[model samples]
Target: MSARPSPIFRNVSSKVGIIAAFTALNLATDYMLTGLPNVKFMDAFYFIATFEFGLSVGLPVVCFTRTAYAIVNPLGAAPGFLIVFLVVGDSMYVLSGYLSRTFRLVEKESSAGDRVLSIGLIGLFSALGFDLITNFGTGLSMVGGSGLQSHLWGALVFGLITMNFPLPLGIVHEASDFLFFSTLVPSSLALLSRSGLITTGPLGRVIGKRGDNQN
Candidate 1:
């Protein structure tokens, strides 16, 4: 007899429902925080979803949530290139989340301070990487039709560092991500764990009472 398919793939509709729900939550937070220049909970949501449901669910959730937010943005729909850049940039969180789960980066047995630091560092690196990539994309878009071959690197640097000189948007974005990841992500995970939404499983390690060595 053939073995049964994994539970994750067994109920397609439930996964869809979960993805839709996360997308809605992300969009709602984005709308509510529209006034905040670079601060938003969408990234945190992506991380949280990945933490809870694993990468299989997190990937679609990030794509749908980001695309919908871009289309329904309060300012306006993003340009096609910008939309692509944003999606690619935001995917850092998804990758970090998956890595954290797979490798037990946030150890359940670790002290609170250590866990917080680990999570914060993850956020910091992910945010920095996201900014670097998207900024390069933006720079390329700006200079692509200008035939400025010699200025490509300068344009990329402009996007990353000196675009807004005094207080760069990238700085604010990175700071907010670090703060949110340090505080919000762990707190939410603990709440979910307590609520039994995140439990020990064979797919990978999770942030709960069990140690990695146990599994």
Candidate 2:
């Protein structure tokens, strides 16, 4: 009989599976909330991925999920570069999550108030960052052939115009991200940690219990 794959291989396989599952679920949730008022889970899900998987895995998965979702997106993927812009926005969430871990910016284990406050701060900044990245991408795409100064001016102009969509919608989305992240992230990390599917990293201590990165 063929020898079973080594424990390391099995572990890596499982992590990939978890990543794929989470990505699918995130997209599914977005689809379900399609008609809701800024009720999508994209930012919150990215926080979970980065919290569970870190930058190396989380960032690539964000890129993949955004691109895949865009390709097969049901509501029609208009503006062709929407996927790229969304990926850029999702990357902000991943980077924000990783930065928290890297700086020990968020509490690992603390009071509910403290944890909520810390995560809220992260979510707030992440929302703003997401808006900036995606809006900036949208802006750049519109002025691709312009000179550097014009490009800069165009980006700023378009970014604001883009952000004006149902202005309060942005606030609602940020609030949703904070609520979900505060309530779900720590618990998910613990459950996945118990399952031995995720690992801690040097700069970012996730679980900080069992395994480290396979790569």
Candidate 3:
């Protein structure tokens, strides 16, 4: 007789443990980087989460994490800020993941020249989308309607430079994150593939652009 699957697997205990560990790592990294004044650790963690888990998983995680962080920190200001931050930032992260997946799929099927263009378009749109949503929410909360234009412009410029561009440091950070967690949570990765959260199709192949075309 074939052996039954382990009961432990039914609870998703291992997957939850891995996510929690990674969440802690993300928080630690944010704390360490918070001293930089310019670096936004939440944003970085948001990106990392989306890249690792995809939007379906990452966005809810981000929302809950941000809510928990706000409850702990309290910031000594309005409580509304916490809500705004969690909602806007989580939405932005989800949008980024969606755009990243879409553009990657497009690029995978395109010619070599289109790959570069696709990436550029994806980066530009992702950054712009993040900037618009984040700044709009921030301005609404902090400065009311009057501040929207200035805040939008400032955020657009900063996001374009810092997040959209293929900065060497950012690339290194993302690559490191991909490598580190992928190694540590190989089972999670396997589960994702099995669950179809990570697709195995023409889209997935094109997204990776491995040229194997076997999905």
Candidate 4:
């Protein structure tokens, strides 16, 4: 009889494959939402993964998916040069998760309402921060050929432009993000629990459910 594969190897293989599939899903979804600009489910997925799998696994999904989406240029080439800032900014979601775990901010007894707001706030800040940092990069890239002082001034000018007309969109994105995280995280935890993808014995300390938490 063939021996069962080593647990470590199986774990690593499954994680790699899952990340790859997530990357593809991100690419496809971004392509589909190409024109919507601020509407996206990406942050929802980020929150769910972080809540369920913890930082080591979840952060990679955030970075890998964003990197792959940027490379695919589903929207256009305009964001190509700004991908670095995006990777950095978007990783804030993962950082929030790390902070939550480190502080035990969402302990097992915490109410569903509390977790929802916590995750929603993380999503909100992440979206807003990503917009700022990415636009700052855009300004710098725009002035690549200019002198240092000129580049700084140019960056400020572009920043102003972004803050004026595009600022409201930031709030819109955050609203959508908050909604996504507040709802999806709990719903996903419910499903994951049911499928035995994670068990109370192992992941309980991190992600558990009373079902009503989502309601």
Please report the candidate that would top TM-score against the real structure.
1
lDDT of 2 by residue, 1-215 (tens): 22211122224655677578778888888788878756667677787777656675677679777887777767776466767778878887898777665555665636777977778667777887777777787788776644798897888678867675647666776777777777777677667667754334453333322554444
Q: Name the TM-score of candidate 2.
A: 0.77
- Residue 204 of candidate 1: its Cα lDDT? 36
List where candidate 3 sits over 4 angstroms from the true fold.
1-11, 41-45, 74-78, 106-128, 142-215
Output the worst ten-in-a-row residue range by lDDT, candidate 1.
Answer: 1-10
RMSD of each: 6.8, 7.3, 11.1, 8.6
Predicted candidate 4 versus true structure: per-residue lDDT over 1-215, tens digit per residue: 22211111125545566566656666677778878777778776665565556665667887888877777674555466678888877777777666555555555336878877877777788777777777678788765545788887788678547743745676677788888877876687678768744434332232222231311
Q: Across residues 68-170, which tens digit of lDDT does each residue of candidate 3 receive?
A: 6555552333276546754675566456545554444433544744644443344444444555555444444444324667766665555445543554434
User: For model 4, what is the alpha-carbon lDDT of residue 27?
Assistant: 66
**Against the hidden reference, what TM-scores do the models get?**
0.81, 0.77, 0.48, 0.75
Cα deviation at 46, candidate 1, in Å, is: 0.8
Question: Which pairs clash inside model 3?
Answer: 108-206
Query: Ranking by lDDT, best first?
Result: 1, 2, 4, 3
Full candidate order by TM-score, most accurate first? 1, 2, 4, 3
